[model samples]
Target: MTTEEIEKVTERGPAASAGVTRRLGPATGRPSEASVLNVFSHGILVVWALMVGVPLLWVLWSAFKDSNGILTDPWGLPTVLHWENWSNAWNDANMGQYFVNTAIVVGGSVVGTMVLGSMAAYVLARFTFPGNRFIYYLFVAGMSFPVFMLVIPLFFVLRDFPGSSLLATYHGLILVYIAYSLPFTVFFMTAFFRTLPTSVAEAAMIDGASHTRTFFQVMVPMAKPGLISIGIFNFLGQWNQYLLPMVLNQQEDKYVLTQGLAMIALQQGYENDWGALMAGMMIAMLPVLIVYSIFQRQVQSGLTAGALK
Candidate 1:
C-alpha cells in the first residue's frame, strides 16, 4: 500500500475502535442504572401525588353527597349533587362566621409578617451594625424552637397583656400568628434580600430618597416574588392553625375555621352530618388552593431565584 493509504488506515483503526466502544458502552449497565433511577423517582412522585390528591378529590365529591351516601359509599362519586350541603355548611355549621374570622386573622397576620419580616431581613442583609449576626442568629434559633413549648408562656403573656385578656380576640390571634410565622419569614427573606443588587438601593439613596422610601419603592418591588411566596406560606399555615386558636381562643363564637371544623366533627357523633363536615372541609381548603393556584408561578420563582443568583 502507498504511505498515504497506510497512514489513513492507522487513523481509521483507532476511530473505528472508539466508535465500537461507544456503541457497546450502554450495554455495560450504565444506561440501565440511569433508567432504574428514573423509574424509581417517577414512581415515588406518582405515589406522593396520589396520596395527596386522592383524599382531596374524595372530600370534594363527598361534599356533594348526603351523609348517608357518604357513609355508605365513601369511595363512590356523587350521583346527584346536594347543593344544600354547601349552604348547610355555610349557615348551619357556622362555617361562614369561622371563615370571616379566619380571613381577618390571617389577613392581618400576613400583612404584619411581610411588613415586619421584610424590613428586618433587608436591614440584616444590607446594613452593618453591632449585634447584627447575633440578631440574625437569634431569628434562626427561633425557627428551631418547638412552638408547642411556647404555647403555655404565650398563653400567660397574652392573658395578662396589661390592658385586658387577649384570649378569644381577633387582634390577639393576629399578633400570635405574626410571631409564630416571623422566624422562617425572616430567614427566607434575609437570604432573598442578599441576592438582590445593592447598586439599585444605592442609586435610590443618592436620589434623595429616605431608607423607607427606597425600600418600599425600589427594594420591595424587586423582592415581589419572595414576598408573594412567603405570604402564601404564612396564609396557609395561619389559616390551618388549630393548636394556637384552640388553646388561646376558647369562646365558641370566636372560633376560627380549624376550631369550627373540629366542633363540626365533634357534633357528628350526635348529628351524623358527614356531608356538611366534608363541605366545610372543602370551604376551608378552597381559599388555600385558590391562593396557591393563582401564585404558583411566583412561588416557584421566588424559591429558586435566590439559589440562581
Candidate 2:
C-alpha cells in the first residue's frame, strides 16, 4: 500500500473507536444527559431539603433567642444564646412529670399494640378460618373511624368505673391508645406477614413446631422490620398526642408535652414568653426527630417491602 493509504486507514480506526466511545459513554464514562440530570435532580432535592430544614432552623434559632430578639428579629440570628431557657422550661413547666407521663402512655401502648397486633396478624395470615375476610375488613374499617366521634362515649365509659375514671391514669390512657393504634398496627403487620413465604411456616410445622411456636420463633424474627415500623408510628402518635391527653387528663401533672406547650404559650394573665415557648417546642420535637433518624431506614423499608407481593 502507498504511504498515504496506510496513514488514512490508521486514522479511520481511531476515528471509528472515538465514535464507538461516544455511543457507549453512559456505560463506560459520563454522558451529557447524566450530568444534566444529576444537576437538575440535586437542585430539586436541595429545594425540598430547604423546605423542610428552614422551619426547623427557625425553631432551633428561636430556642436560643430572648423575647426581645424574637420580637425584633423573628427570622434573624439570636444576639445571645439563652442556655437557661432549657433549664427554665424543664423546671417551670414541670416537664419532668410530663415526660414521665408521656413515657408511660407511649411505652405501654406500643408494647400492647405490638404483642396483640402481631398475634392477630399471624392468625389472620396463616390460618384459614371462618369470617377471615370479615375480620380483616373490620380492622380496615377501624382505620376510617373518627377518633373524635368516640371521645365522649369513651369518657363516659371510663367514668362509669366504681372509683377512679380513666381520667388521668397512665394505664387508662394506654388502653385507649392501644385500641386507637391497633387498627393500623394490625393492618401493617398483616400485610407484612402475608408477604412472607409460607414455606417457612410449613417447614416449622414439619419440625413439630406448633402454630404459636412457629410464629414466635420463626415468624417474629422475620417480622422485626414491621414491628419496628409499627412501634415507631405508635410511639410518635402517643407521645405527641394532645387531644386525648387534654381531654383524658385535665390535671396539669398528667399533661403531655404538646399540652404543656399550649399552657406555656397561653399564659393568660402574664405575658407569654415566646422564646421559652419555642424552646419547649424544640425540646418536645427532638425525641421524635431522634427516633425518626434512628429507625427511618427500617421504617421506610418495612413500609414498602410488603406492598410488592
Candidate 3:
C-alpha cells in the first residue's frame, strides 16, 4: 500500500478496535455499573414502599374488623366489615369533638402561618431593609431549636398570656401552632419567593397598584404552588403534633385529636375496644392522607421550583 493508504489503515485500526471493544463490552457476564445501580435503587424503593404501605394497609383493613378479629389475626384481612366501629369511635370515644377541634385549630394556624410567612418572605426576598438578613437568619435559626426545649417555657407563656390564659383553648392552641410552624414556613417561602419573577411585581407597581394590593392581588396568586405546598406541610405538622398540645392543652373537653387518640389508646387497653381505636386512628390519618393526595403534584412543583430557577 502507498504511504497515504498506510496512514488511513493506521487510523482505521484504532477505530475498528474501539468498535469491537464497544460491542463486546456488554457481552461479558458482568453487569454495567449503571444497570446495577438502577436495580439496587429500584429494589430499595420497593422495600421502602412496602415498609410504609404495609402498616397503612393494615390500619385501613383493621378499621373494618371487629376487636376479636384484630386480636386473633392481626395480619389477616377483615372477614366481616363492622361499620359501627366508625360511629363508636366518633361518638363513644369523643373522637368527633376532637376531630372538630383539630380542624379548627389546624385550619386557623395554617391560614395564619401562610399569611404571615408569605408576607415576611415577600419582603425579605423582594426588598432591601435594615436587619433583613438578620431577621431571615433568625427564622432559619428557629428551625434548628428543638421544640422539646421550648415546651416548658411555652406552657408558662400561654398560661400567663395577657388578657386570658391561652392554655387549653382552641385559639390558644391555634396561636401556638402558628408560632411552631412559622420558622420553617418563612424559610421555605423566602426561598420560593426569591425564585419568582420580579417583573410581574414591578409591573403591578407601575400600574398604580399599591404595595398591599400588589401583594394580595398580584403576587399571592403567582405564589399559589408554594402556598399550597407550605400549607400542606404546616397542616400535617400541626395536625400530628403531640407534645405541644399535650403540654399546653390540659382541658379534657378541648383536647385535640392526638390527645384524644392517646386517651382512647389508654382506655381501650382496659375496655378492649380495639376496633374503635383502630377506627379512630383511621379518622386521624384520613384527613392528612386525603390532603396530601390531592395536593401531591403542587407540593412537588413548589419544592422543585426554586431549584429549577
Which whole-number lDDT from 0 to 100 does residue 56 have in model 3? 89
Per-residue lDDT of model 2, residues 1-309, tens digit only = 266579999989997787677776656445666657868998999999999999889999998988778877788998788987777777776766777778777888889988998899888877798999899889878988888998888888777767778788888888888888878788888888998999988999999998889989999998887788778777877788888877787888888888898887777433567777777888888888788777777656654543655
> What C-alpha lDDT does candidate 1 achieve relative to the native structure?
0.88
Ranking by TM-score: 3, 1, 2
Per-residue error (Å), model 3, residue 263: 1.7
> Over the full model, what C-alpha lDDT does candidate 3 score relative to the true structure?
0.86
Q: Estimate each model's TM-score.
A: 0.82, 0.80, 0.83
* Candidate 2 lowest-lDDT run of ten: 300-309
Residue 154 CA error for candidate 3 (Å)?
0.7
Model 2 clashes, total count: 0
For candidate 1, write residues 37-119 as lDDT tens digits.
86899899999999999998999999999998898889989999998999999998899999999999999999999999999
- Which sequence of candidate numbers ranks them by lDDT, best first? 1, 3, 2
Which residue pairs clash within candidate 3? Answer: none
